[model samples]
Target chain A: MSKFLLATLLLHIPLYIYPILRLCYWAESPLWLTLLIFIPLVSSQYMSRFYLRKKNSVWTKLLRRFADFYLGVSPVLLISTLLAEIFVGFHMVTFGTAVTSVIAITVILGIVATMAALSPMVKTITLSSGKLTAPVRFVQITDVHIGSRKPAFLDRVVHIVNELKPDFLCITGDLIDGQGVSEDDLKSFKSVVGPIYFTIGNHEKYEGVEAIARRLENLGVKVLRNAETHFTKELQVIGIDDMDDANQVAVQLEKQTLDKDAFVLLLYHRPRGLKAAADAGVDLMLSGHTHNGQIMPFNLVVNRVFDMIKGLYEHAETKLYVSQGTGTWGPIMRLGTRSEITLFEISPAQESLFPSR
Target chain B: MSWLDEGADVRSTSLTEEFTIDLYRETYQDRFIPLFVVESSGRLRVVTDKADIPADCKIISLIKSDNI
Candidate 1:
């Protein structure tokens, strides 16, 4: 196994196993019970990936759901158990009581986190520019990860965006996670009014870029591959493909010209290249690949990589907005973070000197 | 002062607008620099580069008498 994979397994296996071992020991269960729990704990991650790839049979669906639920609840259980261990170490509680409290807290927090994941909140932001001659409204949904989330979730998302009545829509990337995404999965997008523009995410490349591009295009979503389109004289939209290379954005920007006078909105998959964009005279940049760590503590790690994790940040003359993703990537659980749909309203800055004219 | 052929060689290709603009910039080199582009309706504007030209607009190649 790769070093990263090995490290993940080493870290996660202990987290999963220790909690169950503690609870079982406190309950005076047989030693064999620890082995039983340990076996599944080690195998669950791989098993979940396997079941997720299977055809949509009832058995596979149920197994996948169970695996995902276990993955989601495991972190909470592990943390609670760790806390219980600390309490035991400090002589604050008996081992049996510590185990009971840990279980109860884990169960309650798990339910709350799962519910939060199911319902994504809408975040509205208004941006005004003196350069803008006209007002434009855009609804941005990123990291929807459609294959992991069923089409029903997309249907609800589309309804929400439609209700917002945006002038246009932008999907910043990770729209689909798996290769199994079909045209049928994207049928709901047809109901959304106005044009929809999409840029590739890292996940799309994994799922097969060519196929995803064709599928999104057939669904009436314009795929912006380091290209741009004009919405009006006052506004222009540009999109750059996601690249692993650090200099890719600078290279891509060199190939394209930006409207220095118009309000330029850039749809890049990640929040990088702020200086390059500002130098090229881009007004606003929107991205969603970070997912703002998707869960707690992970956010701390994610913050180390990305300075602008979620929400609006100003870089020189350019404004960057990173969404916390529109859908869950795995486990379908959100803790200490929210799934969000960002609504942006851009308008011309008022130049009137006197008020109440 | 004789004006260079205003028409020149206007070529078309089946490429994205950005790539096409990049191609024009490469083909013309510095002569392509500081060109004024007009919208489809013929309204002129100064843009940062050729890529800023609207997809439907026409690129008008202008050269200074002493420079080009």
Candidate 2:
């Protein structure tokens, strides 16, 4: 009620004034610029409260503090921007021509800042980099939770995946929200024509592993139920079912004819057993249980748990890249984090062993 | 357990939020079934009843089930 209004106003105010601020900054009008500073200053407290509600539990008091933090920063940013503009405008008003140039620079900086803050969900990631290696191009998309609110979203994603021209595709986990499992939605992956590999995340376990496994297999995806296989002569890819058992992975590795020198890629739903994978000598690992805090400030929560929270990292000579995910899980809005389609270009480490890319 | 990686030697804490009781009910009304639910205490349980609540765990969320 009161909270909702405050939240909506706080969220929408920035969205509303953004365009006006751009206009004022572009025109280099001091009066309009002055107005911009005041509006945010006055609304800052309300905005902070709004932000707090979204971050902490509705029942928690920390949310109120966050609101205060946001409001507190509003005046400072406005004053700084205003002061800088005044300094420039004073110098430019004397010259007249420099006003346009100053405004242009401000606009450019604003655009860059906005882009940085509102980063896009999709990303292109290279699995193996540097010189000398057989390159394997693959795309990994995790947490694609398609539902009524987000129907046909995969169609766009499929188009993007196809544009990348990946040799293979991997879905680490959470293909759907699990509640609304439909035949049409299940067949969405049919658009993915390449050798698609999958591993069950916690969500798949909710929908009946066997049923989901059969359905995915029907669509031509190789759903790995604690299984290992080789994609090429020099590459051995293993898909482990989601669990905490490191011994099971070791046992599975024992049965496989693993090429010690060849690249090994392991797909597990959660970001657990990273050290074990490194010890297992797995060349790479891909995971996506943490939606990287699908909403803003929540990612701070994710940062504390996983070493490689999102994006690429190296540990014990093994490269692990965690996807922020392609789809939103619960909330539709992603404030701080972007959904991603990670692309990996694998290249040979040594010329003698693997085939040329 | 669909989440824990017993195969690896290293283990880390779970990286997800608990499935709120409210969200679980909403998901059921919307007909979205949970694939699995792991409690905060590390108890892993799969959903056997379609009409039942989605996973009530604090550290995990649902990925899409392949079963249509």
Candidate 3:
């Protein structure tokens, strides 16, 4: 049992410890209190089982599950605690001061989680039609992980998209966990929306990029694969595959005869190198790999990972819009960040409908 | 009256022959539906709404509702 406990501890530690330590830093707290809090939190599971011996009600059953699960969360807490200890100790900090630091870290994490849950997140961005008389309307929906265990989530999302009635829809990637998706699941995706345009994300690449691309194409989705399409006389849309294939993106761009005034949009799944995209003279870029750090403390860790994590950013003349994604990854619960569908009306500043105008 | 008089009171002249045929076909669906028109008679006024329509013929206002 002890060996099993040690193995379990080792297994779960990395998942929680690295993220908490990297992202959180508490301003003020006593080290002893932080360590003491973990003791009760860890034992809460056993205590709840003991308490359940005397009760037989729905509330008792629910409380027991909560206790078991939350107590299970102690492994994560333990990892985070040890990380705080190691960091402060390495800096030659006193043992008593270490507990304060850990407590402060937890408080900061709690605050971040709370702030994320409370933030007025963007729910749906709709592009009202007739606003622009452009021949082709390209709508980009990025980071929709539809394989979440969450119920009726995709149905509601598709309903929203149908209401908008865009002429063409583009999916920037991370369609599924890739691990969980089956052949039949991919088939169901075909009926979810009208014709779709897709580009693979790192997750898709992980699950055999070529196979996923071929399967999606078979379902009527055009996989851009560093390809360019002259969507309209005034616009040229290019999909610079994912980050790993940056060279392919450059090669494809070289083949296209890009006009200075043409509306150019690039869908690169990861937001790693915005400079390359800007240098490539991409007018607008769409990406959604970050999920903006799906969890609470993870958001801060993710914030540090990339320059443009979420929202519309202007770099010189290029506009980069990183959506938070339309679906949750694991646990089927989005504590901090809400899923989003971003719609943009790409038009010139003036009323010149014709490119010549 | 010349052959031009037959369509002189038409409100608008559709450039395409297909569109003109379709418009006339649409009138057959509902006989009560009005089709009043006033075409250009060498600077002649174009009767568009029911108010300017000749009482003998039914008049259909292009404005279905003022809210639109």
Q: In candidate 1, which residue pairs get closer than 3 Å at backbone N, Cα or C atoms, i.e. clash?
A: none
Better of 2 and 3 by DockQ: 2
TM-score of each: 0.81, 0.54, 0.53
Cα lDDT over the full model 2:
0.58
- TM-score of chain A for the candidates in order shown: 0.94, 0.62, 0.61
Docking class of 3: incorrect
| Candidates 1 and 2, the one with greater lDDT | 1
Using lDDT as the measure, what is the rank order of every candidate, best first?
1, 2, 3
List pairs with backbone clashes in candidate 3: A29-A100, A30-A99, A30-A100, A31-A99, A31-A100, B9-B37, B10-B38, B10-B39, B11-B37, B11-B38
Instruction: Quote model 2's TM-score.
Output: 0.54
Q: Model 3 — TM-score against the truth?
A: 0.53
Candidate 3 Cα misplacement greater than 4 A, ranges:
A1-138, A148-152, A187-194, A245-252, A255-261, A351-357, B1-68
Positional deviation of residue A270's Cα in model 1 after best superposition, in angstroms:
1.0
lDDT tens digits, residues A81-187, model 1?
88888888999999889878987887788788889888989999999998887788999999999878888999999999999999989999999996577888888
| Model 2 CA lDDT for position A343 | 83
Global lDDT for candidate 1? 0.76
- C-alpha lDDT of all candidate models, in order: 0.76, 0.58, 0.53
